[model samples]
Target: MKPQERSELIDALLDGAISEADFLRLEAELHVDEKARRDYYERLELTTLLEIQAEAEAADLEERIVPMPATGRRTAWFATAGIAAVILGAIALLSVVWAPDPAGGPLAAKIDSRLEPSATGFAVLTNQADAVWDSGGALTEGDLMPQGDLHLTSGVIQVEFFSGVTVILEGEADFTIHSPMEMSVRRGKLRARVPAPAKGFRIRTAEGELVDLGTEFGLDVTEQHSEVHVLDGEVEWSPKSEAMRRLAKGKAIRSGNGGGTVELSAQPGAFIDATGLEEKRAAVRASRRSAWLTHSRELRRDSRLLAYYPFDQPAHWNRTLTDESGSRLDGAIVAAQRSTDRFGFPAGALDFSPTGSRVRVNVPGEHRSLTFLCWVRIDSLDRWYNSLFLTDGHELGEPHWQIMDDGRLFFSVKKRDATKKQKDKQVFYSPAFWTPALSGRWLQIATTLDLDARKVTHYLNGKILSEEAIEDEYLVEIVRIGPASIGNWSDPSRDDPHFAVRNFNGSMDEFAIFGTALSATEIAELYENGKP
Candidate 1:
């Protein structure tokens, strides 16, 4: 086909005006010709750019047409430019309004498939109050909910589905999320608010299914029976053995495992709503915050603390991170921005996303045993090694701590007399504990090096993750922390200008170093007091 003819065919395709035969021809051409694929993308880009330019022009009408003195050549140029702009504007308008039906033809289907967004999750756990899971796993606010079962043994949680359905679940409850608009209650109580967009949201029980019709409703499920209460709209209840029945506002029904249904009165007050849940969460957070502050004050007075950065300095002290342990080991903040901490305190954390972002400190002593703990929110593990802390350079007794690309916690101290043959000379690693699902969630990570016991222990959220024996060859009697950096590695010993890119892509709210190795109970207390 000629260039003009092919362009016309693409235009027709984009406008949804291509006939079946023409679409087939275009599909074959796109499959065989690389130029055709490039042309398609180029056209799409051009249309998008034109649309953006049009919107910009509309926003500033005075700047849309600029006056210029006209020469004969300028006049001709302006005429050509005006014609081109008009054509581009028409194309943009057509592209915006005339989308092809995805089911119309093979080409349309292929294009639509490419344009679809990738599905990450069915819903999000938007809010929670004093939640305690049956599995003893931590589920925080703003966690993405995948298609799986949730067993909440205590407290309340609010989940907002992608399809605009909100559900407040009260424990002890067993719930399963099948999709954005579908869920199941094995045994529990829940209140749901379905917007117009999620009108067909359905909840299944052993006895029946309750489908929402743009309404607020509550449900209770047990071993013997299931109850549905329509609070403000309508629902279609389908019993396993009976025909479907529509229930209006202020109506309720009960379906039993024995195959019978009974009418009941809707009690809106029996289930907690979103507003009530939020109020409860606020009270809980305030109480937790107060308890944490009191514990923090006690921690600062502890003699074992070598250095502690609460990251709660006022705006005027942005450049210097205060050392609460009173060791005078202040840190110099370099190129890091302040951010909100996990507990919702403003400027209570330091974000280290930019290159060369770090907190430089000088501890000025060697230790026989050490404990390091911090609260961090990792955004990504993009680098081969995401630095947590590292001494100036790799010398004997110098410690290096970091997260490996595969999500394992890594710590090592250089040994003075290590042979090349020893494979495990100085390195220790915890099991891989981080995944994409954990991105942006605050985590309490702690590592202790107990030289006397010859053991290295790693903890996550106060729970032991791994404990490895410090081999005889790998044991360093004294660990040095004269000059080091948090969230990045900096080597002042090197003459060369080039440096390794090991900066952490995350935020840190609290970091501390103890001269003595803390026991498991101490670590647990720290997590419990500071948890958000």
Candidate 2:
């Protein structure tokens, strides 16, 4: 790329407007071109210096100069006596704020590392029964198990390592996943079933480590001691101060924190096995599915609903999504595929990962207030704007609802006689609530625009996330949603041939639009009844 173009791309990166494609291109350039890397560091340093200068001016301390050591290639330029003292002082201050490597490495390398995507995991959270994590958010069944500390305060969870080792952990425990074949227990009980392919699976504890020899075993670890029980096969035990010994099935050993080991008979019933956990999860799923079905039936009868899509088609190839609210405003699926819903029912949801994938619908007439709600499982936020419901063309009185790339919930409406300036537009944003850890987990997202009350509210899983007042100058008395789309955006008035790609990278099982703003009690009830 040209120097000007590279600078523009760098500016966009700083401004948070660089597209994924452009970002990848810029990253590749920085990796191969030494000059580009230097330019990037120079740009970053200049930006930081400007910010410091602005702050100093604001504090009326611009005259003060602090001499600090400078490193890197910029040191020679700073040593020149011709440079302004204030600029040199600012550069010195910037160097202190962003200390470079003592060996004189470019700062671009550090910044580039931050731009790289997060590491991928080899294990998956296969199942959980009433699992309550210490982090507050429960891990969903299909979530990828991150390699880190896992604190389970209550219930049981099953994890399947890539090496074919299945581990069922009981609650009130602290565990860490070092790799697919290795883990550590600080405090808790767990049962592991290792197949022949994963024979050498390892488990470390405070006392020592246990190496599985294609065996099924139960391990309990606490501050005072660690215990191991060979449930079905042989395992090699190595205590901190004792010689490694192999123990067969029906044998158990306990090692105290201070020293010595005690032998005892194996207690297979002490830990919940994978099979038992599966049975419990199945029962809970069945109960939740039944309750959701009854709740869905009642929701269809709500008189204030403008349109409701259960996304429950009779067949996978069905293109029409029936409106359960009797509005006859059925949606036509466009290039989206049928997928599993939050309830684990096959072909019960619509996946909108592909380009041009959306559910096209038309709801006639304007409304004084509006509410948009849905249950979505976001796979990733790959686009600048991941659409939930956006009106076509974005004309006056039309509303747009979507999720920002940073995971904030966004809702806005075009006002009557509004100019192109962004300040004239009223937009509501909720604090970012989604993260990489939340990928594939089902979430209830809702947004209400109460023009009469002059307020907008956003909800996540039944609780209010944010509330913003609708300024009188920016409020549209009648909100319109004439021709719109679910999971994507369509701009009819755009002169450019290439359309913006804003399709949601995930699945949605249910969506509803209410004619009036729903109360918090009603939204909470909806979440309670529909949650899986």
The top-ranked prediction according to lDDT is 2
Error of 2 at 377 (Å): 1.1
Each prediction's Cα lDDT score? Answer: 0.86, 0.87
Give per-residue CA lDDT, model 2, range 434-468, as digits (tens). Answer: 77567888999999999889999999999999999
TM-score of each: 0.66, 0.67
Task: Give me the candidate number with maximum TM-score.
Answer: 2
Q: What is the lDDT of candidate 1?
A: 0.86
TM-score of 1: 0.66
When summed lDDT is taken over every stretch of 10 residues in candidate 1, the lowest stretch is 492-501
Model 2 stretches with alpha carbons more than 4 Å out: 1-126, 133-154, 160-166, 171-189, 193-209, 213-216, 220-234, 239-243, 248-276, 416-424, 491-499
